[model samples]
Target: KPSIAGKLDNIQGDIWSKGFPKYYETYYFFSIKTPLLNEKNLFSQCLKNLSTQSPRLISTLRMVREDHNRISTRRKEEAIKQGIPEKRVVLPEIPMSNALIAFTIKGLQAIQAGLQDDTSLRLTDVAATDPAFFAGMTPKEVTALLKDPDQDTWDPLFRSTEIHGMLKIGGSSKGKVEEHLKNIKGVLKHGTAIDDVFQDSPSTPTDSRVDGWTRPNDRGKEHFGFEDGISQPLMNGIDEQEPGTNANTDVNMYTDPRLLIVTGDTKRESSIPRPPWMENGSFLVFRKLEQNVKAFEDLTEQWEKKGCESKEHMGAKLMGRWKSGAPLAVVNFYTEDSKDPDKAKEMNNFIYENEVCPVSAHIRKTNLREDLTENDKDPRALRTKIIRNGIPYGTDYKGNENNTKLTRGLLFACYQAHIEDGFQNMQVNWSNDSTFRTGHPGQDPIIGQVAQKSRGVNGDLETFFNDKFGVRQSVKFQQLVTMKGGEYFFVPSIPAMSDDLGM
Candidate 1:
């Protein structure tokens, strides 16, 4: 059907190659679980037949600048044949296959009040969209829609208010994620509040939660054994910079410069303009997180049987990387030297201001990039940048962690424009802050939510390994990532979700 009407004009891949897409991909997470039913053409013609099917979006203006100018001319001919002094490398994309969707301001007013008594759509067709998507906004906008992460700080099996929208199929074949879930079960097999929000249909629904991806060598590792999507950010703008121009801005910092600059792009007008039919929309922030892989391999194998320095260096110092994604501030503790192979393509380039990678690690408290750039005006550290696209539901051990009874961990997604300036200011000011903006570096000992001192906000991660060793280091414990369910979505622009909520 002209390739399913060319997926209503593509555009979904981001977060560096479809948020780390590549290698036998086959994820599917869906979870609408019904609610808002005033019956507007059953969830707007099942999201306008999921925007006419070829929808595994692909429109970020062909991510390439001559493949980052041939990997920066092969890292300047391998740094002038190994004498060193040539680094910055990026190639970023290459994967694409689609199925994506996201919505929830109660699923866009349950499809704008299910197409508002259809005299053919109006409310000024979504009431001039985005006053933070309608009817008098301001519930303090977004700090996770004012908490309810499962009644009192999480783990009621992650109940953050019954999900209303999020389909996200993504492929690389498990029969292309079941033919994009059989075209979303033939658009919810003749909908009824959309087949009671699809629990693989038969009109199920009462409760459901799903998360997938585990093939690319067990999805490039995150079942708590390190190696995940790797750090990300970059969107660049220099009148699209000339001269062999190939500024890769890793999956262009989660895109959506109001689609692609000011006919829609005008950086967050005092925070909440985004909605010229949501130019290439993007704002999901789902999270279900649950990892405990036998308490992360029994506290990193008791710090590798007390001969400490090898549970791959205590999971590379609580994840500043080194589960073979490398980057414990330029790869050490466990090793990565092959004649300085351009330091693993400058692993998301470094910095912690000589703190030697430990401003609460977990990618240096979520993206500090070039240490929030000296004076280049770091938009509050690039508005708490995010672009992660999660996957890792369950099953992990043979020593290989938790051999599942379902309910494993990590489905933590993210894509931004504003979920309160990127995932609620990096989950309440940097993974539950321990005095950070630059170093007091506590909490975030691998996805901190708070534990041990239980809600005492002492997930402990302070450090100072050696500056004349005045001594100061830590690695406390508690909820090794456990927020059961979450949501806050938008994902528009499959031709503005088939022309503004398919009205």
Candidate 2:
């Protein structure tokens, strides 16, 4: 509502007030065996309690702009010492514990038992309510893109029937996180949280990929050491809390970016008005992607041994950005140590048409922002955006690959308004299609799903020694990251959770 122009602040509290809380997070999956009434009531009451307990909620009169001048002055002095531009310094606030929950179709039915008529239809229709959610990802007819197949051939957990619901608990510190988990454990026990709660669904986490600070100084980076989470589309309608006010309702919101990247698709008849309960909500896609660190390291070592101009470019072309988070199009070189804050200002301000960065580069293929029509600000690119909010789970191995037994990877989570247009289109129409964005650019070497035999200039989108020119020496990359567990869910707004949806 803050971004809706003349409306009041979203009273449910901005989900990002603490700005990505918890250094450690756990995705607690659950299913129910209790009566439908008990499950629904328990979840509803818990939400009411959580609404008030959500960390850093903007319900005060002084947190808004109260210490802006004083804080800005301190920030400026700190920026000078850190060598960052004064305007870019983000003031740190002590974070607190936060919690959120999501439910699948089976999970929803277990709760809303009475939301049915002769056919048993619910008042609020969520992703679980739609057949498409259970159908999972597929090659949409027009898009003609390949998708992670719905078979045992793919990861079993990702097979629609694996996960029911996930309770995500995060806190500012390890102690707080553990404490929150303990409290939630108590709440979820004795048939309140679920009918039968197992610690995990796909058995216990065997080899965890959880680690810390994958950046120069903890910028968003993946375990592979490449900087992550750049080029995120601005959530225009949502505004942050300011000082001296409970929320930024009448103040800072005036200047909040008004460009909404996730608007409702008016062209899609079934989704024109969207569901009333789904107005400000978004779809949450979860994937438990496992990364083989040693394997990735081996690939890099191979490239390093064959020293050449494009040796460094090899890694950059794989992701479209250097490990330092600098985009290849902007830096024009693979710099391993440049962590300049200024680079972020234009991290997403370049294109790869002339092949400065290969067309099949991971970033270019997923975004296609400026490549749409040579126009940098293409609205078409906006529709395919998703807000990624994943966290690195598990820890690393102890020794070399030979003596290691650690399992680690990313808890890949992304929010989009439309599953088909946002997540599906990117995977099928763009990332999987070598012919997309440019002529036969090849598959996304990072996450593309074509079999090795299908890989080529057209079908598989193999990585060209230099894809810019018609290079014949194309390297077919194997799948390093594997999809182990996945689920499609709807993250309802606070109002939808409590009042509008009749939870």
Q: Determine which window of 10 residues in candidate 2 has minimal summed lDDT.
A: 244-253
* TM-score between candidate 1 and the true structure: 0.32
Q: Which window of ten consecutive residues has the lowest lDDT sum in model 1?
A: 1-10
Among the numbered candidates, top lDDT falls to: 2
Q: What is the C-alpha lDDT of each candidate?
A: 0.51, 0.53
lDDT of 1 at 206: 26
Q: Write down the lDDT that model 1 would get.
A: 0.51
TM-score for each of the candidates:
0.32, 0.74
Tens digit of lDDT per residue, candidate 1, span 1-503? 01112222344543332232332333333334343545335555556556654532332323323233444577677777776766333223333345566666655655655454543333343333333333221233332333323345444323434345656665444565555555675665524444333344444442343546663345456787665664544333312322322222422433333332112333454443433665546666676677777777787787667554556666666777666566777655555451232344445544545655566777777766554444354455555566576777666654653435545676777776655566666766776777765547676677656332344355333432322232455656655666655656667665666664445
Candidate 1 residue runs with Cα over 4 Å from true position: 1-164, 167-191, 196-275, 279-282, 287-292, 302-306, 309-316, 319-351, 356-360, 363-365, 374-403, 411-415, 418-503
User: RMSD, each candidate, Å?
Assistant: 20.7, 6.9
